[model samples]
Structure formats: structure tokens, C-alpha cells
Target: MIKVAFFDAKSYDEVSFNKTNADYGFDIRYYQEHLNLKTVPLAKGADVVCIFVNAECNAAVIDELIKNGVKLIALRCAGFNNVDLKAAKGRIKVVRVPAYSPHAVAEYAVSLMLALNRKIFRAVNRTREGNFALKGLMGFDMYGKTAGIVGMGRIAKELIKILHGFGMKVLAYDLYPDMEFAKQYDVQMVSLDELYAESDIISLHCPLTPETTFLINAQSIAKMKPGVMIINTGRGKLINTEELIEGLRTKRVGSAGLDVYEEEKNYFYEDRSDKIIDDDVLARLLMMPNVVLTSHQAFFTVEAMHNIALTTLESIKEFGEGKPLTNEVVEQ
Candidate 1:
């Protein structure tokens, strides 16, 4: 029987993973702790090791996994920045779920945008306390506003649809432009500069790579229109937290909504309410009423979770059967 070890297995993860693996004929071992060099030994005889975004699969961790006879590393999420491809070069195969319910994440981004613009979180809190005055609750209509989307991928396309439904003009930028989709959605394919200067709201949907790291830095922020709202549902490093804090302090950025943070690995997926926050930038962000931060749960819908578990288990099964992986991430 194939042995598969899963790291960072939360309650929700176990529920979906088990449901999908029930008939896969694999013996699964789960650990609540993240996978690292110290925990690599636990995968001793396992053929495959599954990990999530928080697990440390660095060079040292990868080396130890290879030493422990781990053949495959299955990532439940799309982003694989946490994994060191150089270390796993020819030793272990890496695979990820490329697309898992884009609508789930897109809708969440729109929800954040709407909540921030409408001051729903603050209004709900005030209403709960029997204070019904709309003293500071002022919001602009989304209709007729220009929305700039940084990526034209699946998630971005879904966001475009929702924004179009709100009667907002859509401006999109992507390395590879989809002319057909742009025409269909009445989205204008514009340059990054135009998108920044013209958009009333800018949302990031790109991945984190060498070219995309800190894509929304001080330089980019300066190009944006004053009082422009920003939303990021993509990777945390895509926006520089320091620059964002500076913008918020100066009021260069009107309001921001984020589901991810640049240095979220230390704070996300864990409870820190009992302890003082060590990250000063994050602490400052939380103090801003205009900023809304979530625990990187934009893709937390049931459909997305089910797809992730099914795809993850299928990747392991494919590797076990000596077949080429459908979602393989190989170095060129």
C-alpha cells in the first residue's frame, strides 16, 4: 500500500482530504505541525508527502525528505513559492493544484472590496451596540467607477464579471492578453501605468515570482490616483507591506483590503491573540480603520477545498502508478 504523510492538517483539511482519499487505497498519516527538517524523519517510509502553504519545504527540508525516502511533494495550493525547486531538482517531483474554484477567491475579493467601500464591518459593529447613527459611514457607489485588475487569469476574469455586473468599467493587464474575453466582458486591455493612473480601485491577482515580487511598491503606489482603493487576493509578497504602511500613513491610499500579507507565514493559520504581535508593520496595519485583513482564507469555500483534496490525492496516486503528473511543476 502507498503511504502518504500530510503536514499542517487542520480540521477542515482532514475532512476534505479523508473524504477524497477514502477509496484511493493509500495509508495516510497526518501531523498538525508544519513539515520541516526536524519533522522530515516522520516520513521515513512514506512514498509521498503532502504539504500546504505554511509548511517549510526549503532546501534543508527537501534534503531531509529525500534522505527519508520521500519521492513526491504534493502541494494542495497553487502557489509553490514555499518550495525550493533548486534543492528538489532531480530528487523529488513537485506538483500543485493550478486551478481550484477561481470563483471562490474572486468572490471573496469582491466581498472585501464591497465591505471596505460600504464600511459594512464598522457599521455592523456599531449597529450591534444599538448605535444606529450613520455619522462616519459614507460610501461611494461602485457603479460607473473604473476597476483595474492586475492579472487576466481565471480569478481576475471572474472578478471582472462581478465588477461588470456592478456597472463598473474594467481595465485589465496581463503578460498574455486574452482578446476574446476582453471583448466579451467589455474590459479594456491597458498597460500597467494606465491601469494604475486611471482606476478607481486596483486589485492584484498575480502570482509571486521574481518579476512580481513587490509589484505594488512605493513607486507603483505613486502612479496610482489619489484616494484609490487597493485589494490583494494574490500572494502576500506581491505587495510590499512597508510601502503599503507608508501609503496608508500618508493617506496616499484611500482604503485597502487584503487577504494575504507579505510576511504572513509567521502570523497566519495560527492564533496570536494571547500574545503580543512581534511584527510592527502588521500591528500598524491593524490600527488603520480603512484596512481590512483576512487570514488568507479567500479560497476557503467548500468547492475549492473539495477540489484541492481531490487533486492532491490524485497527484499522489498518479505518482504511485508511475504516470506523468498532470499538475507537475518542472524547471525549464
Candidate 2:
């Protein structure tokens, strides 16, 4: 049996994998501790080390894994930005579930947009307290508004379809433009500046690359239409949190929906309600009524979780059998 040291093991993860692993029958050990330098020793004799977005798979950690006889690094989440692929090269194999469900994330982005625009969170709180005054519950119609999408990936494509259904003119920007898909969907492929100036709402779905980090900084926000709504369900560092707060302060950004933060790895998955947030930027963001911060749960749907478990386990099984790993993450 292939031993898998599953790190950052949440109860939901265990539930999903345990049910799916019945068919694969791999020896699985679950640990709530994240995969880091200190926790890497737990995988001393394991054949595979399972990790999530929060796992610290830096070069040093990779070296430790190699010393411990670990051969494979299995990432359960879609984003591998946290992992050092350059360091993992030519050493241990790395594989990820390229996509579990695009709809789940896209739908959550839409929900954020709706909640912010309609002041749904505020209204719910007021009504629950029996203060049902409509003084600040005004919302504009989504119809006839222009929505700009940062990346035309799977989640962006799904979001575009939904936005178009609501009579929103979609403007998309991608490093690589899929002209065929754009033409089919009647989406206008525009330059970043054009999208920023023309869009009433801008949503990010891009990957976190060196070039894309802090993509939404002060300079970019300055080019956007005044009071433009920004929604980010993508990687946290995609937007500079300090700059976003400044934009909100000056009314440059009307509202923002954030499911991830740049420093989210510290406090996103873990419960810190009892303890005050030590990060000043994150705490300031929390104080903003315009901002709706979620705990990186855009991909929490049951269907998505099931697919993630099945796909991750299947990749491990293939690695064990020496089969071609279609989902393997090789150095590009």
C-alpha cells in the first residue's frame, strides 16, 4: 500500500477522501497540521505527501521531503502558487487537480457581486435586529452594466456566460486571448486599460504568477472607472490589499468582494474570531463595510469536493502503478 501523509487535513477533506479512497485502497494518514519544515518529518516513511493551498512546499521543505524518502507531492487544491515548482523539478513528482469545478467558484463570485451591490449582508443584519429601515439598501440593476473579466480561464468563462444572461456587456482581458470563444460568446476582447475604464464591475480570475502578483495596485486602480466594484475569487496576492483599502477610502472603489487575501495563508483557513487579527492591513479590510471577506471558500461545494478527492486519489493511484500522469505538474 502506498503511504500518503495527508497534511492540513480538515474534517471535510477527510470525509471526502475517506469515502473516495475505498475504491483506491491506499494507506492514508491524516494530519491537521500543515506541511511545513517542522511537520515534514511526519512523512518520513510515506511514499506520497498530500497537501493543500496552505502547505509550505518551499525549496527547503522539498529538500526535506527528498531526505525523508518521499517521492510524490500531491496538491489537493487547484492553485500551486504556494509550491515551489522550480525547486521540485527533477526531484519529487508534483501533481495537482487542475480543475475541480469552475461553476462553484464562478457562482460564488456572482454571489459576492450581488451581495455587495444590493447590500445583502447589511440588510440581513438590520432585519435580524428588527431595524428594517430602507435608508441605505438601494441597489442598481445589473442589467445594462458592463462587466470586465481579468482572465478568460474556466471560472471566468462560466462567469461571462452568467453575466451575459443578465444583459451585461462582457469585456475580457487575458494574456492569451481565445478569439474563437470570444466570438462565440460575443464578448469583447479588450486591453487592460480599456476594460478598466469601461467596466462597472471588474472580476479577477487570473493565476498568481510573478507578472500577475499585485496586479491590482494603485496604478491599475487609478485607471478604473470611479466607484467600480472589484471582485476577486482568485489568488489573494492578485490584489494589493493596502492599495485596495486606499481606493475604498477615496471612493475610487465602491465595493469589493474578497474570498482571498494576500496574507490569507496566515488567517484564512484557521479560526481567529476569539483572537484579534494581528495583521493591520487585514484588520483594516475587515473594518471596511464595503468589503466582504470570505475564508477562501469559493470551491467548497459538495460536487467540487468530491471531484477534488477523486481526481487527487486517481493521480496518486496512477503514480503508484507507474502509469502516465495526465495531471502531473512538470517544469514548463
Candidate 3:
């Protein structure tokens, strides 16, 4: 019997994984705490250890897993930046659920854009307080506006379709351009500079790599058109939070929506409503009415969760059977 230990197991995770495990019959152990060096011993008797996005799988944690006789690290989410692939190389195989539900995240990104543009968040707050005046609820029409998408991945493609429904011109940038898709969607593939200068709304759908980290800093923000709305459903580190605060301070950025943050590991999945947020930049973003922040919930739908659990267990079963690991992440 193959044993798998899951870290950062929330109620939803347990329910989904247990339901899916009925088919696999794997001995799965659940731990509420995230996997770090401190909690490494919990995987002592497991052959495979599964982790979520925020779990710490640094060199130290990887070393402990090897010592514990663990053979594989299965990531439940698509993004694997949290796992140190370099350290796990040649020691333990790392696999992930690459595309559980691109539509879930893409739809959430659109929801953020709609909420910000229509002032839905503020309007809901005002109605609860018995203030139904439309004095400051003015919003511009989305039709005929230009929307710039930073990446041309699966999620971005889903968003492009929705943006087309709104009659918005789509401008996209990707290192490896998919000209066929661009032609199909009638999207203009432009340089990053052109996308920044011409777009009415800029949305990020890229991954967080060494080259793409802090991609939307002060220098990039300066190139953007004044009053350009910015939206990020990508990795948190894609935008420098401090620089974003400065952009919001001035009127340079008309409105902003984010589902991720650079330093979100400390506060995103956990509840800290009773405690004060020590992160100054995050606190400042919360104070801005134009800014809307979600706690990394772009991939939180029931379908996505079910797909994640099914795919994750399937990969583990593949590894157990000595089959080809399709979603394996090698050292880059």
C-alpha cells in the first residue's frame, strides 16, 4: 500500500481528497500545519508527501524529506514556485497539477475587473449603511476599452474570451507568442511597452520566475497610461507592493484589483482578522478604496478542488507504478 502525507490540509482539502481517494486506496495522512523544516518529521513513514502552494519546500525541508525516505513531492496546485526544484533534483521527484481549472481563476480575474470598474464593492457597503446616493458611484463603460493581458496562458485565453464579450480590444504580451490563437481571438500581440502605453486596463496572468519577478515595478508603472486600471491574478511577487502603493497614492493608477500579493504567505490562507497586520504595504493597500484584494482565492472553486485532488492522486499512482510522470518539474 502506497502511503501519502498531505500538509496544510484544510476542511475542503480533506473532503475532496478523501472522496477522490476512494478510487486509489492510498493510505493518506492529513496534517493541518504546513510543511516546513519544523514539521518535516510528520512524513516519517510516508512514501509521498503532498503540499499546497504556501507550504515551505525549501532546501532544508527537502533534505528532511530525503532523510525520512520520502520519494515524491506532489503539489496540489499549478504554481510550484514555493517548492525548491533545484534541491529536490536527483533526490525526490516533484510533480504538480498543472491546470486544474484555468476557468476558475480566469473568471475570478474578470469578476475583480467588473467589481472595481462598477464600484460594486463600495456600492454594497453604502447600501448596508442606508446610503443609496450615486454621487461617487460613477463608472465608465467597459465597451470599446483596451485591455492588456500580460501572459497568453490557458487562464489568459479564458479571460480573452470574456473580454471579447465586453467588446474590449485585447492586447497581449508573451515571451513565446501563439500567433494562431492571437489570429483566432483577433488579439493584437504587442510589445510590453505598447501594451502599457495603450491599454485602459492591464491584467497580469504570468508566472513568477527570476526574470518575471517584480515585473510591475516603478519603472513599468511609469510607462503605463495615467488612470490605467491594473489587475493581477498571477503570482504575488509579479508586482512590487510598495511601488503599487505609490502608484495608488498618486492618481496614476485609476483603480487596481489583486487576488495575490508578494508577501501573502504570511497572511493569505490563515485568518488574522482579530490581529493587526504588521505588513505596512499590505495594510496601506487595504486602506485604499480603489484597491480590491482577495486572499489568493482565484482557484478556490469546487470543480477546481475536485480536479486538483483527482489529478494529484492520479500522479502519485503513476509514480507508484513506475510510469512516466507527465507533470514532473525538473531543475531549470
> Mind giving the per-residue lDDT tens digits that candidate 1 earns over 26-140?
8889888888878888888988999988888999998888888889999999999999998888889999999999999999999999999999999999999999999899999
Residue 177's C-alpha lDDT in candidate 1? Answer: 89
- Give the higher-lDDT candidate: 1 or 2: 2
Instruction: Give model 3's clash tally.
Output: 0
State the local distance difference test value for candidate 1: 0.92
Superposed on all Cα atoms, the candidates' RMSDs to the truth, in angstroms, are 1.0, 0.8, 0.8
**How far does residue 133 in candidate 3 sit from its true spot (Å)?**
0.5
lDDT of 3 at 22: 97
Q: Assess every candidate by TM-score.
A: 0.98, 0.99, 0.99
Can you write out model 2's per-residue Cα lDDT over 256-297, one digit (the tens) per residue? Answer: 999999988889788888997889999899899999999999
**Which stretches of candidate 2 lie above 4 Å from their native place?**
none
Give Cα-based local distance difference scores for all models. Answer: 0.92, 0.94, 0.93
Q: What would the per-residue lDDT of candidate 3 be over residues 1-332, giving only the tens digit for each residue? A: 99998999989999999999999999999999899999999999899999987899999999999999999999998899989998988889999998999999989999998999999999999999999999888888999999999999999999999998899999999999899999998899999999999999999998889999999989999999999899999899999989888888888888899999998888999989999999988998999999999999999999999999999999999999999998999987
Q: Show the colliding residue pairs in model 2.
A: none
lDDT, ranked from best to worst:
2, 3, 1
